[model samples]
Target: MSRHEALNPDDHRDLRIQERRDAALGDARMVCIVVPAEFRALQAEYPILFRLNETRDRFSALAMFGFENGENLYLADGRWDARYRPLAIDIQPFLIGGRPDEDGPKQIHVDVDSPRIATGDEGVRVFDKHGRPTPYLERVIEQIGELDHGFRESGDFFAALQRHELLEPFTLEVTLEDRSDNRLVGYHIIDEARLNSLSGTALAELQAAGHLEPIYMAMASLSQFSALIARRNRRAARG
Candidate 1:
């Protein structure tokens, strides 16, 4: 369970957050939700895919980290082995609260129950002795704000993809060096063929909506699959 509280200088003046990546800190995952705004950076390192929600009424973008559930290939030696991690992964223990479209200001909420919440004097302090925000806290606030904006803008991107029939089901089959087989299903990818065949007007519409670049970025990210497979093989060899 999570205990979330709106962050305030008074209540959390001495709170410190552990800045480390490990499975025990909830970094163990095959995939993490991503937004189109992050596609440029994420595409360079991870395979971008899409999955339907449980209700099947909405599609969410994903940055795949491994082939199996609870496996994060990037995580090793208590570190995330990547130059860039998705904003969703970076903003841990803190989240944006309240409606973005509302007139009221958005709030930053912290998960007090997270393991990243330091119990001793071993982590980065969120605030200074004068009750002012620390540099680390400022960075976290910026990250959370960007993530919130990206998440709100993602709905339009998904809607455009749906309207244009650009999403196609994808299944990946992997055979490791040891001859073990792995299969991944229930994911979607950009229909490159359909994208190529789109009418000029359709392309114009997508471009006008600012969704074209990310669409191509997502398609380009598929190449990362080979690197991911290599990582899996390396892990097996080490084992």
Candidate 2:
């Protein structure tokens, strides 16, 4: 269970967050939610795929990290190897919250139970001695705002893709050097054929809506699959 509390200087004056990346702090995940705004940067380092929500009524973008559950190949020696991390991942242990009636300004809430919460005086302080938010806290607030906005806007992107019939089911099969076979299912990728078949007007509409660039970026990100496989192979060799 998570214990979330509204972040405030008075309540968390001495709160320190451990700014380190490690599996123990919940960074070892095979995938992270991504937003179209981040596609340009994410495409350079990770394969961007789409998956349906549990209700099967919505689609969400994902940044693939590894082949299986609980495995993040980008994590090595307690550091994230990627040059850019998705906003969703960077805003850890903090989330936007509002009143129970949902009729007020959104406030920052922290998960007090998170392992990232430091137990000693060894981490980044959230507030200075005078109860002012430190620079680190300000950055976290900015990240939280960006993530919130991106998540809300993603619905439009997914709806556009569906309207244009541009998503297709994908299955990835990999054979490692040690003769191990791995199969990834239940993910979707942009349909290049359908994308190319779209009418000029359709392309124009997508471009006008600012979804065209990210669509191409997502397609380009597939090239990272080979790089991901290389990372996996390297990890296996070290075993």
lDDT per prediction?
Answer: 0.92, 0.91
In candidate 2, which residue ranges exceed 4 Å CA deviation? Answer: 54-56, 98-104
lDDT of 2 by residue, 29-90 (tens): 99998889899999999999999887868899999999999989999887899899888788
Superposed Cα deviation of residue 2, candidate 1 (Å): 1.2
Predicted structure 1, TM vs. truth: 0.96
Q: What is the lDDT of residue 224 in candidate 2?
A: 99
lDDT of 1 at 216: 97
Report residue 197 deviation for candidate 1 (angstroms).
0.9
- Candidate 1 per-residue C-alpha lDDT over 31-147 given as tens digits, one digit per residue, 9 for 90 to 100: 999899999999999999999887859899999999999999999898999989999789888888876434446899999999899988988999999999999989989998888
In terms of lDDT, model 2 sits at 0.91
Model 1, 181: alpha-carbon shift in Å? 1.5
The 10-residue segment with the lowest total lDDT in model 2: 97-106
